[model samples]
Target: MNPTIKDVAKLANTSKSTVSRYLNGSPVKKETEEALKKAIKELNYHRNENARRLVRSKTQTIGIVVDSITNIFYPSIFRGIEEVAKEKGFNCVFYSMTSNKYKESYFQNLFFEGHVDGIIMISFSKRDKQELVEIAEAGFPAVVFGDSAGIPNIISVDVDNYYGIAELVRYLHRIGHEKIAYISGPEDAAATKCRLAGYLETIGQLGLKVNPSWIVTTDWSNEGGYHAMNQLLADGDFTAVVASNDETAIGALRAFQERGYHVPTNFSITGFDDITLASWVYPSLTTVKQPFMQMGMKAATELFRRMEHGEEYPSERHLLKPELIIRDSCRKISEPIATLK
Candidate 1:
């Protein structure tokens, strides 16, 4: 028969309540503790009834809420969080909103109902942040990803998007490509604003003309990118295009190919977020490498730290640097063509 609290308490010659508190890691008398240990060993018990009870009494799992699971970025981030959570013996439960307001609210209620220990929210909007603030103010632990607005006790992890986009634009200008176009993500997104600021800053520094027609914003979807690219191509005379993400870039690439436009030869293309598929696509992609996994891992680790210590080690924003990866997709205008002597 499996060992029970009654069996151990009887063997230790102590009240069940005392044994229960002792096994649950509560303070106990030195003499009673020794008796419990001896009784547990004599019974060859490998588990703690009190520990099980404690676990059952509360939900010790973390919640991860993301905008969309279809995006490659979210999955990579999820993997990072999962790895760290597993190492720390914590379980992760994910809820995808698919950018729906109602679903987001539903999950927020789940957290409030004691279904999770804490949460890591990705790609939250202003309204989402407001709701999250309410939860945080109520003393719930959470770490928000990619929000620039500073909230007390709410940890954040994001990339240096402005700098990353600036670097890409500057690189294009350095290669003598002056007529550049950009396909931006949702205008309301903080990341989109930062990246657009980078592009504008670089254009100004290089004394390049800004064409309003060249800047386009759309949902970060393949079809959105494809349609946006087609519109940009028709409206402007651009030699290169900068997409908000690899998916958009790939979509643009497909549009170009379908229209018989050669990548890097006829036009230069660059994408943000060096997703796995970026390199797999034909002609490969030149993009900014966002450390999605590292960001997620750090977010989870930081949340756990806060939970364990009741306060974060340091309450500050962590902005990770993004690197630009050069590939065949972007062309340099300086290349010399063979001329007859």
Candidate 2:
């Protein structure tokens, strides 16, 4: 028969509660813990102590909700979360919303069904924000990424979207590109808004007029980028275009190539988020590097700290800086203009 907690307690000459306290690492005396460890090893006892503790407490599980699992960025983030969760002995359950309102709400309801100890939401819409406020108010631990609208007691992990894009814009300006266009992500996304602000600010600082027609908003998908680029190409002549993300940039690149437009020669293009595909693609896209894996690791670490300490970990708003990676995608406009003239 397998030895139980009681058997270990008996062997240690300690009460069940004392053994339990020691097992839980709850400030037991060193001598007592040593005795218990010896007793447990001698008896080869292994009890479902965690299960018993969970019956009276949380399940030690974390709920991760993301906009889309199909994206490479999300998978990298999930891998980071999984690594930290495993190290901390916590189980992680993931849900993909697929950017659908109904599915997002359904999963929100499921997460609230007491299966998880806390939640880490990758991105939330305005409507989702309202729902999440209610969830946080109800005393459930939750953290959101990319939106720092500041709800009470909710932690946020954000990127330096504005500065990142601003740097990209400056780089493009340095390359002598003045007639630039922007392909933006969904207007509803706070990150997208920040990026737009950066683009506009950079343009203004460089004494350039913002062409309203040059800015287009899309759904943050490859198709959206492709179509937006097509429309932009038809509407105007631009020396360069800044895409919201690598996926979109790559898509737009394919579209441009299909139409016999040589990247960096006919037009310069840049993207945000240096995803794996960005480097693999022809011309090797210039982009703003978001530390996706690090973001996930930070989020998971924060959640676990909250769980273990049983105290709010100073609800941080982490805005990590993004680096600009230069590549062949962007062209030097001055050189081309000089050659042409």
Colliding pairs, model 2:
none
| Candidate 2 lDDT over residue span 37-129, tens digit each | 899999987767564553324567888987765655677788888899899788889877775454433554443345777778887344355
- 199: Cα error in model 2, Å: 0.8
Off by over 4 Å in 1: 1-60, 96-114, 124-127, 148-153, 188-190, 311-314, 337-341
In model 2, how large is the Cα lDDT of residue 229?
A: 89
lDDT at 284 for candidate 1?
96
What tens-digit string does per-residue lDDT give for candidate 1 at 1-341? 88887899899887665565565444455677788899999998766555575532346689998776665578788889999999988899987777555443466555545588778878734435566555444334567787836665557889988989988898888788999999999866778888898898888989999999999998887898899989998999999999987888999998998888888888899999888899999899999999888998989988887666443244557788899899888777877532424
What's the true lDDT of residue 307 in model 2?
57
lDDT of 2 at 170: 93
Which regions in candidate 2 have their CA more than 4 angstroms from the true location? 1-55, 96-114, 124-127, 148-152, 188-190, 309-312, 336-341
For every model shown, the clashing-pair count is 0, 0
- Minimum summed lDDT over a 10-residue window in model 2 is located at 103-112
Prediction 1 TM-score vs. true: 0.73
